[model samples]
Structures are given as structure tokens and as C-alpha cells.
Target: MSPFRKVPAYCRQSRTPIPFRQKQNEGLEALNTPLGAPRPGATRRKPAERAVARTIESDDADSLRAGRRRLGVVLKPAAQARSRNKLERLLEVGLEMMNEIGFDRMRVVDIAERAGCSTGAFYQRFADKEALLEALAQRFAEKAWTLLDTMLIPERFEGQPFAVVVRRMVVVMVRLASAHAVLLREVVRASLRDMRTWTYFSAMRDHMMARLFEVAGHYPEVTDKAAPGGPIELAVQIILSSLISRSLADQRIIAISDDDYAAELATLMIRYLVIDDAPWDAALSPTVD
Candidate 1:
């Protein structure tokens, strides 16, 4: 015998009625509803809950963009005068805050407040604190490069004795280091935590090394030691490290005075690189008749 059960026609018709599907239609309608609108047959979310949802969505979007930015995204500079001023103000305030409380403790909200802007404005330019720091690091790198390029030109030291040139170079380096001492110290600390920071500083070091090599080429004694990764490179590294350490360290605790430290560093470079005469000195000296 076939075991088959037949539904009553009336019950079958009731099951397929339009009203029964209306609930399902309402659910679909709810899914299609735009944000900030109430769903059919559903209670509206509280204002706080709606706000939290918006915040989450906004943050998620910002985070995705920030992640992309962290991975070598290039942000465009502001072209409008007002935007440029705001950007500069934000950076200046951020630097001051970072110096005062250090990067780890610095807050974007505080930076915005100090700059007379909103946190939203800060995020518009810098995706996050790390991005802000990267900007500052780039700024410092550019300034340092400009200073080194101007000061280390071979022609500038053409007639000067080698020791005098070394002293002048050391003074320029010291001035640069001292001017950005706090920011650099923060950068050093950030480098310990962030690979981007480390990469930036490493690039700066490489650039300065290249410039030093160019300058060293003008002196035979230094040039003789200037083979790639040679003693001249080592000496340059030592001079850079010493200047950075002195700038970041507490002067009161250090045994040497600033002048003495600068002099010693200059002497160290002079002796290490054996820069005794300018490249033109031998030619420029009066020949015996």
C-alpha cells in the first residue's frame, strides 16, 4: 500500500495566503531599508545605539584607509591656503605635544585642541598618530638634507684648512641636532616600536652618508679611506652617533661642556679621516722659485 497523506484543500490554501508571506516581505524590506530609517514592524534603535553603529562604521572605514596609508600610500599636500594653514598648525601643535608628553603619551585630541581644530580635522590629514609622526619624520629628514647639502658643498670649504672644514661641519651638525633634539629623541623611541619609523631614519642616515661621501671626495686623505663601507664611513657613523647622543642626553649629566664636546667630535673626525689639507691647498700654495 502507498503511504501517502493528502492535505485538506482549505488548509493548503491558508498556508499559501498572501498575508503569511507579508511577514517575510517585511523582513526583506527591513534589510533593504536605508540607515537612519525605521524598519517595518520593528522598533527603532535608541539614539545611543544608532550613534554607536555610526561610529563603528566610520571607524571601520577609516581603519581600512589608514591600513592602506601605512603600506606606502602617498597623501597629497593641501593646496588651499586655509587647508595649508590648518595642516601646518596641526603639525606644529602635534610636535609640541609630542615633545612635552612624548609620542607614546601624546593624544590626537589634545593636538587638535591645541591647534584650534577638531579631531576630525586631524584625521582628515593624518589617518592616525602614526601617520602624523611619519609626516614629522619626513619634515625633519628634508630639513636635515637641505642643511647638509648646503653646508657640505666642496666649494664652500675649498680654501679652508681640513681641520677648519671638519670643525665647520661638526658645528652645522651640532646645530641641526640641537634644534630638533626632542623630536629626534621621540623618533628614536618610535623607531624601536615601528618599522616605518626605523625605515625613515635609516633612509635619512643613508642620504647623509652619501652626502658625506661627496664632501669627503674633495679631500685626498678622507677620499683614500672612502671606499664603500670603509673607515671613512665608520668615522662618519661615529660622528653622527656622537652628535645625536649628545643632543639627546642631559647636558648636566655629561662631563664635557657643549663647546668641548663639539671640539672633541671635530678633532676626532679630523684625526680619524686624516684631513690635514684641502684638496686645493697643495696647488694654491706658492711654488718655490
Candidate 2:
């Protein structure tokens, strides 16, 4: 049986009234009456009433933005360029302030001041500092990926030894980490305390590992066990562990080049993945279907 029923015509008519003279008359009366207390010649809104009047008159984001813009308190770019320019400027200012004051100490007001706007303008663009930080993290990650993509050439791997492929991949990762040290440091810190950061890193790390396993699958000579316990696991552990260790060690040593770390890590990984003195076909037999 149907639980819902159509309303009877009379019930519908009673619930939803057809607007006529009653609403029209009320509207006309409102327009004719003075909003505040009427005076002899001029209707003078009281001081409190006047403030309320002004509040109601300009009670919107656009109005507040316009007011600030008119006072030269904010930058008012065209709508087409507004979002892009505002976000870029916020990230630039936020990062600088974060570096100087630390993330927790940096306030939205400080960011707004650096941005040459008010707190209202900053809030209009970002809900809070964390949201702004997330945007910066995402942008930095994208830039890092672009750097890695440019350095890693898959075609170079086709005829070369697996050792060469491993070298190039590790070198690229180290270089990328070097290029974005500030971003990486902040993201790592944020990832430790922030759930959103954890989710992003976890997904990105898993996806990259998944791709490595897929590529490893193409070369059956590489492994017998499933990743990340196979050849790919050794590579992943070497790359991540060495990168982290080198970053910490460099703070003490101050002369650790990414190339040196890459070369060393790459050699170790190659020693692990490559079979010594065994022919490729003999070393890894295709699993029988």
C-alpha cells in the first residue's frame, strides 16, 4: 500500500493560499510608512537606529568587499582574475608568515595584512589558515610531480639494464625532494598532525607504489612475490628511507648533495633487484598458465 497520499483539492486550497489584496495592501502600507521614528520635517533615525539602518543597508559580502576596496584596504581585481590572483597572493603571504612566525602563531589578520586586505577579505577566500595551508600543499605537490615527470624517461628504461632504470628513478625522486624542501618539510609536519594531510599523502603514496608494482609486473625477471614485499618493496623502502635520512643528516652535515645520496641509494637498490651473473630468461621463468 502507498504510504503517501495526494492532498484533496480543499485541503490544498486551505494550506496554500492564493495571494491577492491582503498581501498587496500590506506591501503598500510598508512603502508608505517611515521605517524609523518620524520627525517634524525629516525622519531622523536614532543613533542606534541609524547604525542598524546602515548595517541592514550593507549586510553582504559584496558590500563589505566593496567598502574595503573603496577605502583602499583591499585589492579589487576583475572577477575573471580575482580567484586566481587572490589565491596565489594568499599562498605567497601565508608561506612567508608561516616561515617567520610558524603556522600556529600566524593569524588570518596577519595574512590579510600581508595581502593588503581585511580579515573579511581573507575569510571570503579561505575559511581559515588550515584551508589556506592545504591549498599551498596541493600546489607544491603538483609542482613536485611535474619536476619528477620531466626527469623520469620511461623510454630510457626499454633497452638499458634494470640498474640504470633504478638509478634514474632514485635520482629523479631525490632531485624533486631537494627542489621542494620547504614545501616537503611543511607537508610532512602537517601530515603528522592533520587528518586531511594524512589522507592525501596516504593516497598519493599508495598510488605511486601501485604504479611501481604494475611496471614491475611487466618485468617478470624482477620478482616472484607480490609487492610491496618483492623487488618494488626494496626500491620503495630504499628511496623513502634514504630520502628521509639524507634530509635529516644534511641538517647536520650541510654538504650532502642529492646526487650523492641518489647515486648511493641507486647502487644499493640495483644490487638488490638485479641478478648477479644470471641471464634474464634463466633468472626469472614465466609462471605457467
User: Top model by lDDT, which number?
Assistant: 1
Q: Residue 241, candidate 2: how far off, in angstroms?
A: 3.2
Q: Please write out the lDDT profile of model 1 over residues 171-193, one tens digit for every residue.
A: 66666666677877877777778
What are the Cα lDDT values of the candidates? 0.70, 0.60
For model 2, how does the per-residue alpha-carbon lDDT over 87-116 read when each residue is reduced to its tens digit? Answer: 578778987877676677888987898887
Per-structure clash totals for the candidates: 0, 0
Tell me the TM-score of model 1: 0.67
Q: How accurate is candidate 2 locally (lDDT)?
A: 0.60
